[model samples]
Every structure is written in C-alpha cells, then in structure tokens.
Target: MSLLDDDAFPDMDSVSRDRVAPYIIRTEKRKAIDANGKPLFRPRRTQMAQVAWETRHHLQQLLYEAVTDYVREGYTTRPCARRNATSVF
Candidate 1:
C-alpha cells in the first residue's frame, strides 16, 4: 500500500507529495502513540538537513577524487565513448 493516499493529496504535485508523505505517516504514528500516553521522539529539522547535506557533500567529494585519479593516470585524452569511460560528476 502507498504511504500517501492519492485521493487525500489530489492537489499536491508528485515530487512534493513524495517528500512529505513519509513525514505525514510519521506524524500520524506519533499522534497515535501520544494518545496512548507514550513519549514521542521526533528529530529536529536542522539535524536531518545537516545529515542530508553531509551525505551529498561526501558523495561529491568521492566523485571528484575518482575523476582526479582517472585524469592523473593519463586517461584525459581518451574519448569518453569507450566501455570504460571516465565521467566527470
């Protein structure tokens, strides 16, 4: 089953709906727990954002290092259409 019901979010665009659907499900679960007198531990938005930024940054760094290594090994002059192509990320 989909996390988000299309009928409930008919006006939302696909990308935005996808991003928010999980959060909506989490909030509903938290509310259910709260009704049962259980403590809810929601993460701060800043912390989540920081983690995403760090992950993206690390991936970019790795891509840069790979490209640099390929170039340093005298592969820059070769055409990129080969089976073992070196792509710049």
Candidate 2:
C-alpha cells in the first residue's frame, strides 16, 4: 500500500502527516519530555507556520540540487542552463 493510504502507517503519531508530492514523511519536533515520559511539543503559536515555510524552502533546495547535478552530469547542452542552475543558491 502507498503512504497516501490512511492505513499505510497506522502507527504514526497524530503529529505527522504524509506529503503528496515528493512523498515526504514529516514529523513534529519535541521540545521536551515531562516526568511521565511523554513528548512535549513546542507551543504552536507560530511554530507550525514557520515549520511549513522551512519545509517548503528545503524542498526547493533539494530540487535545485537535483537540477544542478543533472546539468553537471552533462545531460543538458545549453550553457545558459548551467549558469542558471548554479546561480540558484
């Protein structure tokens, strides 16, 4: 079964979610643990949004790296493409 299936990872905690594209499995960060040994996540005030933005940027970087690697491997013939690829970051 695919990860998109609800039961594919039935044991996953409620804090995690499956991504559609790139199929990333994201997990929540634990800020600390109490005496009971349960995970205590950071306050969500704006943390969730910040995390989402960071994830997006990370994916973009991955894509950029992949493209650069493809170009570096001589798969593309255009000189401008090579210049543009490395200029991304």
Candidate 3:
C-alpha cells in the first residue's frame, strides 16, 4: 500500500499530522486568503531527496567558507590543515 494511504495504517494519522503541522497551522491561521475566505494555497508534497541534497550542498558551502576563513586568519599555520581545508571544496 502507498504511504499516503492513511486507511492502511490508522497510526499514520498522528505521524503525518506532526510531519505536516506547519502547513496545517498556516492554513488554519488564515494568513493568506482570497476574497471568499478560502485559503490562498495548499502545501506541496515534500521532495525528501531534493531537500536532503540542497541542505547538504548549503552546509558544505558554509563549512568550506568557515575553514577558508580560519586558514586565512592564521588560526592554524600547519601545512596539513591548510591542505585539508582546500580539499573541502
């Protein structure tokens, strides 16, 4: 059965509720609504793999910048540390 098939597993309701809580809360808050009082939007399905990849890429960039700054600021003068920092890219 598909994971989204809530009827297959009743316990999934609570699990899914927690997972999509942000979207549900936003909808309930009426932050964005049309003239008729309906919500202006619905939440899109989460792309787990894409999200994971983007998060990894962003974190890697942050780490690389931090290491580069450390080396540039002379926080560590060891040749090995300098070489290792450059390899992060």
Top-lDDT candidate index = 3
Write candidate 2's Cα lDDT for 6-80 as tens digits: 654454232132333235555547546778977777565643443334765988878878889976775655776
> Tens-digit lDDT track for model 1 on 20-83?
5555534454454566687575643553343334765988878878889987775855665332
- lDDT for predicted candidate 3 compared with the true structure: 0.57
Task: Give the distance in Å from residue 61's predicted Cα in candidate 1 to where it truly belongs.
Answer: 0.2
Ranking by TM-score: 1, 2, 3
- Model 2 clash count equals 0
Global lDDT of each model? 0.53, 0.55, 0.57
Give all TM-scores, in the order shown: 0.23, 0.23, 0.23
lDDT agreement of model 2 with the native: 0.55
RMSD list, candidates in order: 14.6, 16.3, 18.1
lDDT of 3 by residue, 18-88 (tens): 44444343445436788997878785576556333466598887887888998787665776665544532
Runs in model 1 deviating more than 4 A are 1-56, 74-89
